[model samples]
Target: MREEFGSGAAGGAAAGAGERGPVVVALSGGADSLALAAAAAYVGERDGFAAAAVVVDHGLQAGSDRVAERAASQARGLGLEPVLVRRVAVRESSEAGGPEAAARDARYAALARAAREIGAAVILTAHTRDDQAEQVLLGIARGSGARSLSGVPPRRELGDGLVVLRPFVRADPSITRAVTEAACREAGLDAWRDPQNADPAFARARVRASVLPLLERELGPGVAAALARTADLAREDAEAFDAMVAEQIEEIVEHAEAGIAVSVAALAANPAALRHRIIRRVAEAEFGRELSREHTLAIAALVTHWRGQGPVEVPGITVSRAGGRIEFARRTGSPRRRRGCADGDRAEGGGARGVAGTPEAMEE
Candidate 1:
C-alpha cells in the first residue's frame, strides 16, 4: 500500500470520530470485511471502546447461515466481546431489488437497527478502494455527473443516529485479504469467499474479472490505483459541488405537498452544469434512487418543450409542471416508496469504482 494512501495498510490509520454513536462493524465474511472487523477490534482495544459486529444473513443462497455463524465466531475471536449476528428475510420489495442489492440493503438495515439498539454513533463498512473504483466506473457508465463520479464517501450521515464510515476506502482489498489470511492462519481458521464474485452474472463481476484485468494489462499494473485516485479527486470536487448546490437549493427550492419543489424558472437561469446537478439533487431527495440520463432529460424537456399540465412519470417518481416550476415527488406517495426513481436507497450503483491501495505479498 502506498504511504500516501491513508488506511491502506492493516491497522494503519487513526480512528475518525465525528457524530459517532454505537460503533457497529458490518462483517460480511469477505476478506475485505473480516479484516475490517479485526481492525475495529484493534481500534476498540486501543481506544478503550467496546465494539460489536453485525452479520446479516440475506438468505440469498444455501449455507448462508453457516457462513454467518462462522463470521460471528471470527468476530468473537477478534475481541469484539459479543458479536451479534442476525438473519433478515429479503422480501422482494423495492428496497431489496435483486439478490445482490437486496442483500446489501437488508444488511445495512440490520446494521442500522443494531446500531440503534446499542445507541452506536457510527456504522463502519469495509468498502475497499477497488469497490470505490468500480462504483465510479458504474457511475460513469450510467452518465452520472461529477457527484456520481465522486464514488464512496469516507464518512457520511446514513440514517438517524448513525453516520457510515469507510475508513478503508483508500485501502487495497488485496492488503485486507492478506491481513485476513494472516489472521486465519494464526488462528487456524478458514476465511470465506463469495462465489458470486466470479459468477459473471453481475456487472461488477465482469468489471472485476474482465474489464479491470484488461485495463490493468493494457494500461499498467497500477491501473486500479489510478482509478481509485481519480475517484478520490472526484469525491472531493463532487462534495464541494454538492455543498454549493445545497446553498443554491435554499434559494430555489420551495416546500410542496410532494416534497421539495424546484423552481424551473429559477433553475433555467442557472449554468448548464448547475442545472443538471440540481436536477439530480432534487431527484435524489425525492425518489432516493439513481435517476438515469433519460429520466433527467425527461424532466429537462418539461422546462424546454412541454406546453402545460402534462403528466411526466420517471422511474420511481413523478414530475408535474404547474405554473413555471417542476415538482418532484414519489409516484405512489403510498407512504412506502418502491425502489426505482422514488426509492433512493438503491442509489446510483455505478458512481465510482474503488481501487486497491496495494495488498501485500501475493503468491501466483
Candidate 2:
C-alpha cells in the first residue's frame, strides 16, 4: 500500500508536507475507510507526518450525526488528530443524476472543504478493487465508451492545491473490500455498515449483491479481478487518445464568430475514432455539454460525408459545415431545428458511446 503512494502527487504532497502538514482521511465509518484511517495513523507516525480524519454526514438517514461522531471518535482512538465531522445537505431530487450522485457530490464537497480548512497536503479515499469492478460493470451497462469503462481514477486533482488519493484502489494486487473488513476486525475497530450498500433500490447495491456474484459463480472465480484489469487497460488507451487529441487540437481547432470551428479537412484526415473524440472534446470544452453518440455521429457526418448539408442541431449546440470547416455554436429558441438537410442526414450504424468526463459516462 505504501508503494502505491510512492509515485504521483501522493508522494510529492507527503514529502512536501514534512512534519508541518497533515494527511486527511475521509472516513465513512465503513470498513474500507476505517482501515484506511488505521493505516494512515501508523504511517503518519512512522514517517513523521500528521494524520487527521473527517467524517461527512449527508443528513439523509436518521441517526446520521451519531454515526458521524462514532466514526470521528474511532479515528481519534486510532491516534489521528483533529478529527472532524461535517454535515451536508444533499438535494437528491434536484440533482440531475439522482440520489446517489447527489450524495457523492455533497460528500466530496464537504471533504474538500475540510482539507482546505486544515491546509492538508493530501486527502485519502478508500475505494477498493470491488468498487473499481462495480464501476466497470456499471459503465458497461450504460453502453459507455473507454473513459467510462476506465472506472474511477486513483488520483484526481480536486482543484486548489488539494489532491485525492485512493491507495487501495491503485494497489498493485488490488485491495478487496473484504481485506479492509479484516483489517478493521484485527485492529478492534467496530466498523459501521451503511444500509444503502445493501438496499436493492440502489443500482450499485444490485450490482454488488447480484450481478458480480452470479458472474463469478457461473464463469468461475476472478471475474472481479478481470474487470478491474480491464479498467486499467482501458484507462491507458483513453489517456493515450486524450494526449493525441491535445497534441492536435490547437492546430485544427480555432474560435469562430459566436462559436468554435474545427478544420473539416483535418477531421476527415483522422480515423473515425479520433474524429469522434475531437468533436466531443470541442462540445465539452466550449459549450459545457456532452454529445451523445447519435449527436456525435451526426456532427462527424458534417466533416466526413458533407454534401452541402445545412446545420445539425443537437441538445444544446448547432453544428454546420461551412467554408471548409465544421462550426459548433450555441443553439437558441427551439432545442430541435433542422435546415436544408433531411432528418436522415446523420451518420449511421454506430452504437451508443458515452462522452468522457460527463456524468452520463460515470453513471455509478
Candidate 3:
C-alpha cells in the first residue's frame, strides 16, 4: 500500500508552468477513489502542491446525497483542502447503453467544473486495471475497433487548460482496494460502497461479476493483465494512425457551400482504414453525426468502388459525392439534437465546444 501510494505521489508532478496550481481528486467514495484522494493529499503536502477533493453526487439512487456527504467527510479527514460535494443530474434513457454513458459524461463534466473552480491544472481519477480489462472486453464484444479496445486513457486534456489523470490505470484493483482500506483505517475514515456497482441491471456490473470470472476460469490467470496490455498496445497503434490521418486530412478536405468536401482521388490513394476514418471525420465535423461502420464503408465505396450510388442519409446528415469530392451536409428540415453521440461521450462536431477526447472508436 505504501509503495502504491508512493508511485502515485511521484507521478503527478509535471514540470514547468502546469504544476503551479492545485491538484484536484475526483472522490467517488469507492475504495479506488478513496485511496487516490488520500495519496494525492499526501503527495501535495510532501511536494508542496495544493490539493483538494470533489465528490460528485450523481443522484441516481436513493440517499445519494448522504453518500456524497460521507465521501466529502472522508476527503476532509484526509487533509484534502477545500473539499466539495457537487450534485449532478444523471440523464435516464430507454435506449441501450445510453444511461451509463450519460452518467460517465456527467461525471467528467462535473470534475472539469470542479477543477476550474479551484484553479487546478490537473484532476485525478481512480480507474484500475480491472476497469480497463472490463472496458476492453466490452469494446471487443461490441466490435467497435481498436479505439474502443484502448479503453480509458491515463491522461487527457479536458480543455480550459485542465488535464484529467487516471493514476491507477496500471494498478491492480485488488491492490488498490487493499491499499485504500489500509489508508482509510490509518486515517480513521470509512469508505462507502455504491450499491449500483453490484446491480446486475448494469452491463458493467455483470461483466465484473460474471464474465471476467468465467474468462479467468477458462483462460487461466492473468487475463485481466493481458487485456490491459492489449489496450496499451492498441492505444499505441491508434495514436500512430491518428497522427497519419491528421497529416493527410487538411490536404484532402475542404469546406464547400453548405457542406464539407473531401477529395475522392486523395481518399482513394490512402488505405481503406485511413479512407474510412477520413469519411467519418468529415461527417462528424460538418454534419455533427457519427457514422456507423457500415455507413462509413458505404461512403468509402463511393471512392473505392464507385457505382454512382446516390447520397446516403445518416443520422443528422446526408453524404454525397460530386465533382470528384465527397460532401456531407446537414439534412434539410431536420431538428437539431444535442451536440453529442448516442454513446454520449464523443462530441458530434469538430469545434472547440465539442466534447474533449478522442472520437468514439465504434458505432452503435
- Quick one: best TM-score, which candidate? 2
Q: For residues 152-199, could you state the per-residue lDDT of candidate 2 as single tens digits?
A: 887788887788888777775557888788878888999999998899
The sequence of per-residue lDDT tens digits that candidate 3 reaches over residues 1-364 is 5546645542453321145588888888988788788777766666677778999988888898999898998888878899999898887553323666667778888888888888888888877777888889878866778788999887788776788777777543333344667766766667787777788986677888899889999999889888989999999988988888888887888887968888989998998888887887777766676666766776787888888867665656767889799887777643334433443222223232222222222111
Rank ordering of all candidates by lDDT, starting from the highest: 2, 3, 1
| Tens digits of per-residue lDDT for model 1, 125-225 | 87777776676776666565666577777777775646777777755454333455665465555668889888777777777789877988898887767
Better of 1 and 3 by lDDT: 3
Q: Which regions in candidate 3 have their CA more than 4 angstroms from the true location?
A: 8-10, 13-19, 93-97, 170-188, 334-364
> Candidate 2 at 226: error in angstroms?
0.7
What's the count of clashing pairs in each model shown? 36, 0, 0
Residue 63, model 1: lDDT of 99
Better of 2 and 3 by TM-score: 2
User: Using lDDT as the measure, which candidate wins?
Assistant: 2
